[model samples]
Target: MANYFVGDIQGCYDELMQLLSKVDFNPSRDQLWAVGDLVARGPGSLPTLKYFQQLDGAANVSLGNHDLHLMAVHAKVKRANPKDKLEALLDSSEINSLIGWLRHQPLHQELPEHKIIMSHAGVPPQWDLNTLRAESLRVTQALQSADYVENLLTKMYTSGSNQWHLEMGELEKRIYCINALTRMRFLHSDGRLDFECKVSPAECKDPDLTPWFALEGKVNQSHTLVFGHWAAVMGEVSSTRIKALDTGCCWGEYLTLWHLEKDEKITQNKLKKS
Candidate 1:
């Protein structure tokens, strides 16, 4: 059995299917790891969720920002973004079950045998593998708890820097961990998150801001990290340890699938306009 790691599907179900076919994926045998943003911006959120659910034990996903937003919208803690095209999913009869499954999904997944870890936005520069695992579990438990809508999702919607400090409250710390694992891209030299910049490295105008993976002395060569956010980079980063799989599939780009054991990639072109 092989392991295939895919980028942000973003509801591009046709592309996802084509890519899986290219890889000759067998739900009963092959394992599929999605780096998240599974639903949103494209045309098939409900169908995409159904497809993944059918995979059962064969598929694993690291929850992305869009994925969390969908759960928040479903729980009535946040309004749906006008451009995400999530109405069909929200209106589905299985919305409750689908959202419940999504909430229980982990923020980080480690493949110790492969020396790899997967997350939506990439692991924080400050966290070691053990710390990453603990923080991920903490957030997953919070999201799966009875008061998730009020305790976690509601408090996690703030924009700008999410720097953690000892003086901050527990809720603030949780929110910071959530942002670091799911929404992080650029970070200031001082380790504060820079949410304003979404451009590729060459296009970024800010001198103080740096891509999280490029931060000096922050590379963790101990394991290969796979992530899917920062589509603007189109799966490019300075570090050899970090592999970016989001090739902007939702933006009329290709959907990337990584063959983990072989360290090879298979890509499928966008099958429809977003």
Candidate 2:
């Protein structure tokens, strides 16, 4: 009856297995929460996808940036760049079904009892649980629809404010995707989205652009935010209630798992890919 949340897997299937073995994870009784990026830049994307596909009922996964990139490529919304070595999955016969399943996953989830909130990338400082879930539902619904979601991904980057507006177009959607997945690291001095910096120490071109969790007057301080995406930050949430999970397992680092109820952590070292 314990729920464990894992950081970005990033296709490190072997290490994932080892971590699961260490925890003695029981699919029937215990549940697993994955913060997303189940594939990409690692050695075992195919197996990882297959294994998790089978664990459909036992686990909950939020889509990560890399996961969306895989989906975009699958849908022909985008091309596979040389850095993306996802050919195995793209060539698989079950590619459509697999991508469909991944796309259907929610962008955010809330566990009221534990006061736990989960998303691949951290939520904006302005959004509370209800606002986050509603906006996320809009994006998820659009992506799942047969409409040209390629347009959505195209506009998912964030060069302006972090706040969502009803007037935003496809470009904003793409910016939202980027902010939610890849381009998030620091907040601008004026509390806008900064798409450039990745290094920590929290200092940047403008020091006032604190990280999202550090923004002043955030409304959703009531719950604990558990997220991944920022490997450089390791597991820093900046704010007291927020927690990061991505330990950079795909980059020769450790895979991290945190127990929701006990606040215990388990780290598994990984073998680097050649």
Give the candidate number with the greatest lDDT.
1
Residue 31, candidate 1: alpha-carbon lDDT: 92
Candidate 2 TM-score, true structure as reference? 0.89
Q: Candidate 2 residues 173-206, lDDT tens each?
A: 5466446544466766655666567766454556
What is the lDDT for 29 in model 2?
A: 91
TM-score of each: 0.95, 0.89
TM-score, cand. 1 vs. native: 0.95
lDDT by residue for model 1 (135-221), tens: 788889998899888888887886543885657666776778789888889988788987889999899999999888885423266
List lDDT for all candidates, in order. Answer: 0.86, 0.76
- Pick the TM-score winner: 1
Q: Every model's Cα RMSD, please?
A: 1.7, 2.5
For residue 107, what is the lDDT in candidate 2?
79
